[model samples]
Target: MSIRPIEPDDHAALLALWRRTPGLRLRPEDEFVPFCAYLQRTPGLSLLCERQGRLLGCVLVGHDGRRGYLQHLVVDQPYRAQGVARALLRRALEQLAGLGVQKSHVFVLRDTPESLAFWSAQAAWEARGDIQVYSHSEESP
Candidate 1:
């Protein structure tokens, strides 16, 4: 698969991809305008994998100067076993390193067993076996 920077125009394809992919709870397409905006602001950090013009996978990476965060990693069902996600991750890490991010983190949902196992198998440093994630959305009261 050809790994390349995601374009603002790719948003539609991504929405369609996310709808078909399991293990993802995506925001409504109308609520996701910041995607390409951030990708434009950060440049090169978010990427997509395609082959023969078919979308295969994608990853979104960003940082706060001290550390990097990865999100929205999804692979086409047909491309799962072909290393598309791995390639996207490798490229993201390399770019994050170049940005002077010493540590990188990925937030995988507990409900997604396949995603959890996929990330755990990478031997993430420390592999936080006992940590919990807590968050409150802006709409939460």
Candidate 2:
């Protein structure tokens, strides 16, 4: 398998992957226009893993000049437990560090047991009990 930076052309394939992945939650930001805009906003930070030109796994990464955010970390079911996710994460963090981003966060939904387990097993990541996240949507008054 090989790892590479995500390009605009990969969006369709990625969407298919995300759709099939059980635990992923897609939002408006995942649509084509916003996805491309995000790529433009933070270039070379998102990535994919593939073999023989087939998409195996992917992770979306970006930073706000202070902290990095990771999203949509998914691997094909057949490819799980093979270290694909870890490799993607390591590479993502390395890229963020290169951009002087020292800290990163990934928000996993409480309903996704598989996702929770995967993150819980990550030795380098810590579950934050001291902080709570609140989000406001523009669509919501």
Candidate 3:
């Protein structure tokens, strides 16, 4: 698979990939158009894995000057376990290092076993076992 930057034209394919997955957030296709535009303008950071003119997966790496966020990493089911996500991540980390980013962060949903396994297997990534993620929701008074 070839890893390349996301193009505005790839929006439809990206949307379709997400649609095939069950229980994923369903957003209007138009909602993602602006995101593609933004990503193109920000910098050439996001990478899309393609094979035979088909999008296989994607990863988005966003950063401020000091730190980086592994914003989104998703591989098509057929492409999983083939090192697509790993290659994407390695590229992102190399880019972040070039930009002088000393620290990086990614949050895996607690309920997803796949995510837990993926991150846990990364030898270079320190697993902060005691770290707890919290959130608050407000209800109408």
Which numbered prediction scores highest in lDDT against the true structure? 2
Candidate 3 on 1-141: residue-level lDDT in tens?
798877677777877876775434443323576667658654777788989987888876777788787744778888899999899999888888888986888877667677778889988888778978886756648
What's the CA error at residue 46 for candidate 2, in Å?
Answer: 0.1
Best-matching candidate per TM-score: 2
TM-score of 2: 0.97
Give the worst 10-residue stretch by lDDT in candidate 3.
21-30
The parts of candidate 1 lying over 4 Å away from their true place are 28-32
Query: What's the ranking of the predictions by TM-score, best on top?
Result: 2, 1, 3
lDDT of 2 by residue, 13-37 (tens): 9999999999788999999999999
Full ranking by lDDT: 2, 1, 3
Q: Decide which is better by TM-score, 2 or 3.
A: 2
Give the least accurate 10-residue stretch of model 2, judged by summed lDDT.
Answer: 132-141
Q: What is the lDDT of candidate 2?
A: 0.96
| Candidate 3 C-alpha RMSD relative to the actual structure | 3.7
- Span of ten consecutive residues with least summed lDDT in model 1: 27-36
- Positional deviation of 35 in candidate 1, in angstroms? 1.5
Which parts of model 2 are misplaced by more than 4 Å? none
In model 1, the number of clashes is: 0
